[model samples]
Target: MKLVDVGGRTMAYHRAGAGPALVFLHGGWSDGRAWGPQLAGLSDGFDVIAWDAPGCGGSDDPPREMTMADYADAVAALVAELGVEAAHLCGISWGGGLALAVWQHHPELVRSLILVGAYAGWKGSLPPEEVEARVRRLLAEAERPPAEWMDAYLPTFFAGAPPAGSLELVRSMMLDSRPGGLVPMLTAFADADLNAVLPTIAVPTLLLWGEHDDRSPVGTVAQALRSAIPAAELVVLPGVGHEVNLEAPEAFTTEVRRFLQAAGATLIRVSRATCALCGQQAASEDVPLTWMTSVEDGRKRLYCDRCARENVRSIEGKLDPVYW
Candidate 1:
């Protein structure tokens, strides 16, 4: 367990291994420990950091009035404090919403995105009536004894039966929840509608969803996201549910590892690319590279940070670099 101060709040995170930063954001009612399999399993090949968001796990409770922007800023601050220039953000459920918020606000700090059983926020994806009902149910659950709700909630968490000890694992994590944290975090989730931010995302994105996910069904929510984000890839884990990582950890880990390795290779290619405008070489793979599809041949062309900044408009317009 490691701690950092972000915006005067104490944030706790579990980190392992060393390489390109791969930060995990868990679903609502869960904490960083929810990512235990990922943190330990993927650490061998990449730096894996799982954080207990404000009001969850070892972190301090956020104010009742906390908004999505506040959550996004705290995440960006935490990553910067850890000396990670950019990270591949992997989030599930509500955490996936937070990941989208982070990318919407801090695009420069994100390398790629991995969203599992995610939402474009309830408002962005679900019917208004359904969103309200879910919000009310969650709020009521926060007020009840953990045991009373766990039995009912546990059934919905998985597609069919849970793996041995999986039910206990989820129960223990939910027992640690408090209303102060739960209400505000979930409220932010319900209110968020990041549909507008989807088309603007330029980074590589991988969407993992359970084929039988009840909470965020792949057909509606996942397909909507896939259609919205540019070049996004979707992988459905058969016989899984919203808790895809818990029920199918091996398959989940494999998909994530393959996606990240491929994304890393693209970064390596970007590192080797000479700036078409300035003929300058990138200092490292981490250096930012702006890639534009050639209007004529559709091949990707690279520009270094300086040249990219100087002609941002031209690049946005997809005008040929030769003309710039």
Candidate 2:
């Protein structure tokens, strides 16, 4: 365990390995230890750092009024204190939102981003009311036989059959978590909205989603993210849940390793015609250009034809015939 003074708070973190820094941010109802499986495997290849967020595990409790931006700032401060110029950032669930916030506000410090079961906001698609209801139910059931109760809630987080011991692990973590810490974290999550900042993230991004994640459903949130962020890759894992890293460590590590390796490469081949406007390779001619945007001065600033036409129509009071 290591402690760093971040904004007057004693933040607790654990580090291993010796190469490029890789920071792991755990989701709600979980602490940094949730990333144990991933750290165990990835630490050997990279410098893996996992920390307990404010009020969780070994960290000091932050005020209940703390916002997502505050959490992101804390992470940025930690990176600076460690003298790491850049690092790979990975987060799950609520932590995923924090990771996105960090990337949005501190792109220069991020080498790449990996988000699992993340959401843009609670407004669109998954309404706050629905998420609140589900979270309430799960929290209420925490005192009961966690394994059995969690089995019912598991479907929302995962896709196919739950992996052996998956429920048990979740149950243990839930039981061990500090309920006092969870309250404000959940409140901060309810207030998060990363949509406005998504496009500002310039680092390579990989979104890992469970095929049947109810908390942050795959189709709407994942698709929206893929469309919003340029050069972002979405990987939907079959038969997995909200905790893909725990449910399928092998699969999760494989995808992460591949993305990191690709990110480190110097020469990337992108189509001239397609890459001219959007810096990504066009997989097929039929690929939709709605989300494809142009990068300007190292920052992706190009808007798709649809967005351009919409802007013109909004201002000119008429649709452009050429765009149509």
Candidate 3:
């Protein structure tokens, strides 16, 4: 586990294994830990990184009225901070929507997209009344006290009884979230409609959903996404609900691995970089973050994003070497 500061707020993430990075974005009310199963299951073949989105887990609370672009940029920064050039993006529910936003803003950084029980955005995918109703529901949910919120919200996540401790794990994560986060985070999609952006996505996309998903029913949402996104494929997991990854992790991993494999993506070592100042070494992709450059004579130098920031003033005055 590691933490990075994005836009002044901190985000906690878990990274494992090596290869093409597969970034997992968890859904609303949940944190990166929601992908625990996938992180462990997929780490062997890919560089899996799951982050605690703002307002959940150990991450900082959300700023007032965060928007889709805000969420997307934060994710982009998180990915850039990791030093990966491009990655296969996977998101669940709201995370799926955020992933779409990332695609719209940072297409160059995404190699492919794996969206599970996703949406274009409530405002974009659902009728006006439905969107309002959903927003109201989330707002009401945010009003509940921690214990009551846990008890009331936990059951709806799964179609059937969850294994022992599973419910507790989810409950704790949801309840741990800052109450003020729900309204803005949930309502961000209220005015967004990503329908037009679907056809423009040039990367490979896999839309996986739970057959029994009442939260974002597959027949309606999945079909709509499939029809809109060019050549996008959909897979429905029978008996699974909104928490498809948590409910059928093994199956989810199998499906995603197959999708990514077919798309010819796997974690591979990136070019390496050596800091000119401290002589520290890291993958070139991880540079700018963990290491930085300096030119003592006439050679190019590399430095860390952090250390570079500290010397931003001096770096700004450079004659030719510029800060990125």
Candidate 4:
């Protein structure tokens, strides 16, 4: 839960893992903390960082008027602050467009792109009628109270019932968001059309969508992304919905890990950390709050923040990392 200063605003982020950096851009409803599954799943071998984008989570809200480009700039600033020259940008929904914008403006900072349930912005990916429909729906929702807004918005995020408590979790996250920011953020993205940038992107791109994603179905947005991006890979998970990562994390995790690994994009950071012996659950920290790597293997692992300060140690090496 560390915060970085980006453009005079505090941007909250989660950092973990021991390999090439994977920066996650969350959808509109959920912020960086929503990437719990990804932060855990990918951190095993990749440096995973999820940002509470501007106007969401603990980050500062954008001014009354700001475009999608402004969001992109904040992302670029965060990446630079993290000292990462280049990283794999993974975004879902609105975050996907933000990721594209990052590649659009700051190409050097992105090694690859992974978009889930993404759009070129409504204007860029959908027909005129569909775009209009979304605008009206969003505008109407903006007028409602947070609880009502979330109640109305939540159903569209899924095809049917999702995991227990998922709906509630999303509701809580949405409520935590500021209405003023959400409206402007919505307006900013709705008008954005990065269709032209899709074909021009040189990095490897992976597009993931839920088969039953009615919100941003595969045909319109997903198909357009696949067709426009050169040699991009597209995967559709059956029974899943628009919130691909949350609704089906295991599947989403598998696709991303496989895609990045195959493209040779997830090069493990050839660095290690050593620390005083700690108790079992032997999670080691390589980059302090950024990683809690396992020491079961030969890769010298450091202590995770939690296990680091403990005075107890295993003299017999019997309390190995694998026990956890």
Best by lDDT: 1
Off by over 4 Å in 4: 265-324
**Order the candidates by lDDT, highest first — what do you get?**
1, 3, 4, 2
Clashing pairs in 1: none
What is candidate 4's lDDT per residue for 216-321, written digit by digit as tens? 8897779988887866889999988898888888888999999988866332221222232442332532243122323443222334445543432333332223
Model 2, 206: alpha-carbon shift in Å? 0.7
* Runs with alpha carbons beyond 4 Å of true place in candidate 2: 132-155, 159-166, 266-324
> By lDDT, is 2 or 4 better?
4
Query: What TM-score, computed on C-alpha atoms, does each candidate reach?
Result: 0.83, 0.75, 0.79, 0.79
* Overall lDDT per candidate, in order of appearance: 0.82, 0.71, 0.76, 0.76
Candidate 1 ranges beyond 4 A from true positions: 267-324
CA lDDT, candidate 2, residue 161:
53
Please give the lDDT score at residue 238 for candidate 4: 93
Candidate 1 residue-wise lDDT at 321: 24
Q: What's the CA error at residue 153 for candidate 3, in Å? A: 3.0
For model 3 the TM-score comes to: 0.79
Every model: Cα RMSD to truth? 7.9, 9.2, 11.1, 14.5
Please report how far candidate 3 places residue 121 from its true position, in Å.
Answer: 0.3
